[model samples]
Target: MANHGPSYGLSRELEKKNQARFSLDEAIEVLLWVENVTQLPYSCDPTTCQNAADVADLLKDGVHLCKLINRLLNNGSRAPFNPKPKMPFQKMENISNFLEACKAYGVAEISCFQTVDLYENKQCYKVIECLRSLAAVQLIMSGFEMESIIWLWKLATSCEI
Candidate 1:
């Protein structure tokens, strides 16, 4: 019998594809856009950075990206034409999988774990920060938050988790 856990090869391939599709320059631009949308600080500039700082910035962005993904999965709005919507479990699952992949690929840092813990533990300010950070990322990733807004609304109104 074969073990049926998530496919490590598939995950790595997906991560590689994602990285190929979005280069560091593109990621930086996305991060800056997210920052502007969410009114957060844009901490990194692609033009000037040491390797360590670059890694740190990428990790920080990864944390923000995770939060945004969670918000989109949990409470984002929907597409205008999606009249009969399915649950967002798939999207949530995708985000979780992607985060795990990021960790595996060494793109995510230790601070991400700390941030996750802080959010889960109900550290009030940290939670708010997390939300803001995520919102920014979602705004960048989703192209105007249409999907996020709808998903969030559906999650709020639907009783059929």
Candidate 2:
């Protein structure tokens, strides 16, 4: 018998990666478009840094949501983070199309557009930022770093309610 946990996951993951064959540049561009059109506070520029680091940064900024909730719980009125410009309806629709393209291109199985309520939930923008960051890693990350990238994905996907 052999250890099956990591090996099984790795094989499954490799199969999935092989099936999804989009270029790194394509993934990055779509993600960047989502970030820019949403006017998210965090940057999702793939040209500047590693995907894991970018995801970490977005997650760090997301901590403010907890601070914000705490302030509200304490009856404080001030906003915890600066407000971002509203993403126009046209731009939001465009982002949905871009995400669809990402999926159609087999870049990654992204579904944030389906669950995100862009009109009401501000946290959704941060989620999009994280998703875009993760999308950047699909083709570029090395075998040695895949575990860390998965951890980053888990962190990025969990949005505190």
Candidate 3:
């Protein structure tokens, strides 16, 4: 059986605490950047998203995510991993590969979301955090200011504004 979430008492309160940290605007930004970077196959207009749930739905399959990472790493059309996985296990495999690539691309292990996180909407904020980390690392590698990125990370993780 799958753990949907706690339904009562202290555990429920803790579960509620884990909710609502994600920003729709930042998620849109990440989606736009991904669309721009990978030219996603479908009509991806992230601006239309009303909430983080929408973003989660878009990325649940992990195909676009794989393509985004592939474009960043290879800068070509060749897909070394399975580009389109039909089964649940295969899709999870793609997400796993994507996580591994992000780690290899300088995203720390602690900063990454587990496959189930994105797949099951367990903690969607971590997905944005991983993407934000990837963007920061990529920018730093390309000679961007590290201090600014640090500030952004701090701002992102901090409580309220």
Candidate 4:
């Protein structure tokens, strides 16, 4: 009812001929050939033609051929390749409206309601100004010459406001 047999055999001659089909250089050459044929201009020449007439002719013909190739490659369908879909104008308008509402609610004034809050808000514009002010106060508290604090204050204020 059943027969079992050796399904296959490779002779020494066949074994020697059945090598891996492609070398690394051959694979690279094939890829390069495909890339060259598929790319715009399709010419192997890397340099732009120097003659004005030749350059103009090449550009004219190249543009037409590129369009033809692109049509064929895309099967006459053009699809955008954007990674992110565009947001609707309505959504952006809503965000702007929200921010305007917050501003109208005096959210900005909350940032500078107290002395500490005022200092915190002010330092956000320039850390060097804050550091100089702190260093001056420390020097004054440590009984350093008052001239140093005054000099630092003058130096800090001299910068563009």
lDDT of each: 0.39, 0.39, 0.75, 0.31
Candidate with maximal TM-score: 3
RMSD of each: 16.5, 17.7, 4.8, 34.3
- State which candidate, 2 or 3, has the greater TM-score: 3
Q: Tens digit of lDDT per residue, candidate 3, span 81-109?
A: 56666777887888888898888777899
lDDT of 4 at 91: 31
Cα displacement (Å) at residue 25, model 4: 1.4
Candidate 2 residue 60 Cα shift, in angstroms, is 18
lDDT of 4: 0.31
lDDT of 3: 0.75
lDDT of 1 by residue, 8-30 (tens): 78887764453343334433444
Off by over 4 Å in 2: 1-87, 107-110, 122-150, 153-161
Q: Per-residue CA lDDT of candidate 4, range 85-151, in tens?
A: 1443333333233223323333342322222211222112121222233334434444664344444
Deviation (Å) of 94 in candidate 2: 2.6
TM-score of each: 0.28, 0.28, 0.79, 0.17
lDDT of model 3 at position 19: 71
